[model samples]
Target: MIRFENVSVTYDGSARPSVRGVDFEVPEGELVLLVGPSGVGKSTVLGAVSGLVPHFTGGTLHGRVTVAGRDTRTHKPRELADVVGTVGQDPLSHFVTDTVEDELAYGMESLGLAPAVMRRRVEETLDLLGLAGLRDRPLSTLSGGQQQRVAIGSVLTPHPQVLVLDEPTSALDPAAAEEVLAVLQRLVHDLGTTVLMAEHRLERVIQYADQVVLLPGPGERPLLGTPAEVMAVSPVVPPVVDLGRLAGWSPLPLTVRDARRGAAPLRDRLTDRQPRPDHTARPPQPAPPTPGRRLFKRTKPDTTAAPPVAEVSSLAVRRDRVQALRHVDLTVTPGETIALMGRNGAGKSTLLGALVGLVEPSSGSVRTGDAIPHRTRPRDLVRRVGLVPQEPRDLLYADTVAAECVAADDDAGATPGTCRALLSDLLPAVADDTHPRDLSEGQRLTLALAVVLTARPPLLLLDEPTRGLDYAAKARLVTILRGLAAEGHAIIMATHDVELAAELAHRVVLLAEGEVIADGPATDVVVASPSFAPQVAKILAPQHWLTVSQVREALR
Candidate 1:
């Protein structure tokens, strides 16, 4: 059991508490979903239970928090480790071991458990997390979702009665996320692990949660109750829940399957649906189109060529003592957009790094023919390739947003004076001196992309670039990437947004434990692969389209 008595946490260095006066409890063996937009203090609440709030994070606590009758204020992380196992949004941040097997054993080894006990727990975790075949694999070799599962397995190896996970599926593709979520649901239903997890993708896991704790947006009170109860009164609800409300269904549908059943007057509703056939199917692209060689009109670049754009033969990378990429082979032809798919640890990022030389392959080769990617005299990768990392701010360093792009010589794109320009399409006051870091997560992402556009690289590598963004921002990113692809740039992105992949990517490269499990057209691989097909898309396709507009269009 977990209890919070009017607990309000305020970080010492901050002016306001991340979460305001909040109180809630989880009876033993209940799965609670804590949700809100990014930075709403959902993590802070979980931190309070794991002793990270006032301890590791160092904040002022106003009220009391008791976990299974033990005062949370007094217990340190190590002290609470046995009772609570926590995982964060980013898998790399919390990782300590170099291999999957070693990672599973790390937590137990730290607790000084018997070797025999540790071995048994490791084997059990491998089976429980569906990682039995990956015991000997290197941690860096698995896909993003696989890596995340490994993280979960490591934490669960201790068999903590209560488990707290923050955005466990945020970094995974739809199918991979579903695989992980299914395992989580099984943990609560079968093993009875008290689960407290926070996520932004509510539509995917809402039905699985026994309780939903909603931290309303600013100037609103937090809500806590059963999934149906809280969702009824809550400001943000899933599509299915909204459908239930609109359709006047008795019990709101938590899942899409239920939503379909509740939608009894579907044909009648379709008769009233209007048609907007002059519609555009393009993504909400963040960056404006780059000016190609033609000055008068923005002409499409030549996409078709004889040889492939990138070819990696027997590529390998080692992290610490473990091999991340073990003799992996991959190829991307000109004008092809490939979505890199895998569970969390599947060396997607590592493989991407080797392309531009961020990581040195231990053995094998990464060859870029005559037009080598970022093969410039200086390490100005922008000349050939542009990389947008998961955390957009990592590449940002400028006083004003406009100046940041200008620093990258974005002005090289003909005369901006020609159009009074649509730079303000994304940012309002693109003054020459606003610090990039001061902007919101969505704004910062747009700014970063704009900077990359200045480079005009033929090959673009985006790494989970949609993270911490809203629906609008995600839509914008998809549009931008698709526009770039249409204009002839070959994009390879390691992303967890499966819907984005389904809509934008032309091809997909599925990786598992650092090996290229499958590589081909996106439709063929993702549709066929067990852990790559997006759940929402799967639920809506064939009879109906997955996207909102697609359904509306079909009805029309």
Candidate 2:
């Protein structure tokens, strides 16, 4: 249904082409996953297929790019709107309507469909996408997962033959992410709609894909073939895939359920009816802190009973009719690192917003030692707490990275020399005079971090710091945050990256529907929560090994 032959998209006011001589094809009814680190032209390819590359994005197109036998270079987005539906990485930027029902009808209205047709189509879509119950809710009131679903339903109402989504679940918690994916899977299986999605979280979507397309950045061609074929070549493989490789299993396990089925003895072992040695590996971990373990550190500053640095009690927040958080309680000591995780729409982000006093709790409240968090001003919050939003560019605006850092400082913390020194470490040799927004996605995210650090908040909150970042960029972030923690900062981050959580979070808290379901040390919590369990090392030994480093250390 889509074809690109030596396609190169050159953007205006830029020398290098965004996409360089790329070639690929997606046949009808095939679910092909397009994956690479951010800014690798994956979105450009999608735009080309949907007739938005050279059209809306404003670029000179070279070579041939066609979708469903129609040349994209000649057709505008409106002309191809009926054949292709595109949803971007962020849903907020795409919402032009107020309510969920209106969002779904916008696309159809643009097509000049009849009112009768629109009503019938909207009703069918709402039910089909499980959005009927949420029809009257405002788009702003819906959860991240619900918002994305509305975005999908908006495009899919016309029943487009080809559906393209870019990182649809990147911002969602695990559960909310799963809910949306299930709807997508149903659309593909039941309606036979062709799907082409680009995503970073491979573990969640790889199993459902019939074909995998691995796009390696610059100077490399796309890898197209079966999931097993492409994963073997990619630098990283999903955990279950890695397990299948190690276990000498046939065909391969695409999902945990697939792994269980093909491994042959998993269910038998669960029933305590197994003789196979492979079926039984490690003991299941427990819920709370183990007695006598140093789960948290203590210090003697002055007073004998000053209590913890951060505290939450019976906190609750309601998103319209849905209670995003309910009677949730948590605490963090000075210098402690906590990772927040849950299924998408499970309140991970909500809890983080509560921590910073953004979402006023419906009842109960969050309090920090000598201060009240809710009553604090935004400027005061920044001085005491730092946050890096999900999008890199949201916080960037200054002319230069150095200037961006200086803007956060009140002429006290950020001197000209200090700003230069901070950029030297955070962003290397990024030109001090270059526009902060002009840099690459990773560079922009790094620069944003430099700005937040200028305030030097004792409490730091990072929301999905690894999104759109390359491996090298992610490492630099981990290093910077680790140093901050060592220097005694209470850093809390809401993230979808379980591996990062395993490595960085001194404590891990599982948030679901705005409740703190699980909490404790990182290793202990990960071992208990299947969602945070290590795919490779956990399968390898499963004993006292929550991470590869632990396994390596034990082996040594």
Candidate 3:
């Protein structure tokens, strides 16, 4: 259904093609997963399908890209809208309507479909994506994951023959991501829709992919084959596949079930050698006085007791008459990493907002050191707390990455090259002169994080920090966060990436309906919960293995 022949794309100012000589054909009714490291031009290839590359993005396309025999080189995105539907990395930019229901119907309305058809498809999409409860909610009010569902549903309502999605499940929780993937599976199996998607979170979608497309890097030939064939040598792979490799399993398993089937011996082997316990055992100094006690520890005036960098007590946040957060209480002491997790619209973002002073609590209080975050001055609050929002672009304004870094350094009162150095450490491949807007979603996230880290605030908050980051990038982030925590910087990340929570979080705080449901050590919380369990935990069930690294160490 979608074909690319000797395709190469180079932006106006770029010295090299973003992707070059990419030749592939995605059969109808198949889902092809496009994956590679950050800045690898995965998004560039997906854009060619819907004619967004040369036509809409102002890049030059060298060869033919056709969807259903219509050459994208000759046809514009609007002309191909009927046959091709594209959902980019950023969902907020795709919405043209205010509410969830309206956004879902907008694409069909543009297509001039019958009102009845539009309404039926809208309802089906809402149910399919778990957006029924949110049908009336404003697009802006929904969480990042909710917005992603709406963006996907909006395109799906059009019922295009070819669906192109970039990081479709990046923002979604594991359950929500599975729902979206299930819907995609149904589309491919039932309606014969061709899906071409690019996602950095391979673990969530690798098992669902019908085929795999590996873009080694810019100007490199693309590898296309069955999922196992491609993943056997693919640099970026999910933990299940890595475990399979470790055990030397033939025809490596892609799903947790298959891995578990072959993991009996490995599990027995690990039964004797205790797996390294997760890093949640190290509680912050002067651990809460009692199980339910609220201890008010502060950075010392003349002593060495570094108090909790952030504290929230009896917090309630109401927006648009909806209780986004209710009666929540939490504390983040220095040298601690806390992960906030729950279903979409469960108020994870709202809680993060309250911590950063972006959202005002309807009742109760939030304190970062001596000052209440919402009441503190902007300049002063920035030094005490820094947030890398889900939409990292909101934190960036300068055109070039170098300029943004310079501005960040100035704002943070850091050394001249501080932000740039952090950027290099986080993402070395990204050119300093590249426009922040033009960087890949992962690269953009890294740049935004570098900008935030420049401040070196006592409390750092990240919302969906690993949305588009690949395995290597995520590893670097893990190291960075660990270093920061060691330096007495308190870190709280609101995320749905369970693997990340397993790797970095000392404590896991699960939220639902604007209330904390579970707050405890990572192993007890994630290993016991099936939905939030990482691949390692799933494969090594009852073994408490949270990461491939942990398994490797245990085996050694």
Q: CA shift at 395, candidate 1, in angstroms?
A: 4.2
Superposed Cα deviation of residue 19, candidate 1 (Å): 1.1
lDDT per residue as tens, model 2, 1-556? 8887988877776657767867888888778898765556788888788887888778788989888889988888888999999998668878998999999999989888999999999998888667888899988777666787788788888889899998777666565567778877877888878899987677778877888877677435677888877877676466676556655577777766666566444323323322222102221122222123221222222323324657888988887778898989888765567888876667877877777777788888687655677789777676666777766677877777657766755532544464455556665646667776556555676777777776666677887877656544565677777666654567888887776786577788888767888887776777776667655424532343344343333333
Please give, for residues 184-286, the per-residue lDDT of candidate 3 as tens digits. 9999999999999998888889988889999987789899999999999999999889899998899899999999888999998899886565466764453
TM-score of 3: 0.96
Score every model by TM-score: 0.75, 0.81, 0.96
**Which lDDT tens digits does candidate 1 get at residues 358-378?**
777788777553444333432
The better-scoring model by TM-score among 1 and 3 is 3
Candidate 1 TM-score to native: 0.75
In angstroms, give how far residue 520 of model 3 lies from its true place. 0.5
**Lowest-scoring 10 consecutive residues by lDDT in candidate 3?**
287-296
lDDT of 1 at 181: 83
- Model 2 segments more than 4 A misplaced: 114-117, 120-124, 127-129, 241-254, 257-307, 318-323, 361-365, 391-393, 399-403, 409-412, 415-446, 470-472, 530-544
Name the runs in model 3 displaced over 4 angstroms. Answer: 283-304
> Which residue pairs collide in model 2, if any?
173-343, 173-344, 174-342, 174-343, 174-344, 175-343, 175-344, 176-343, 176-344
Candidate 1 RMSD to the real structure: 5.9
Best by TM-score: 3
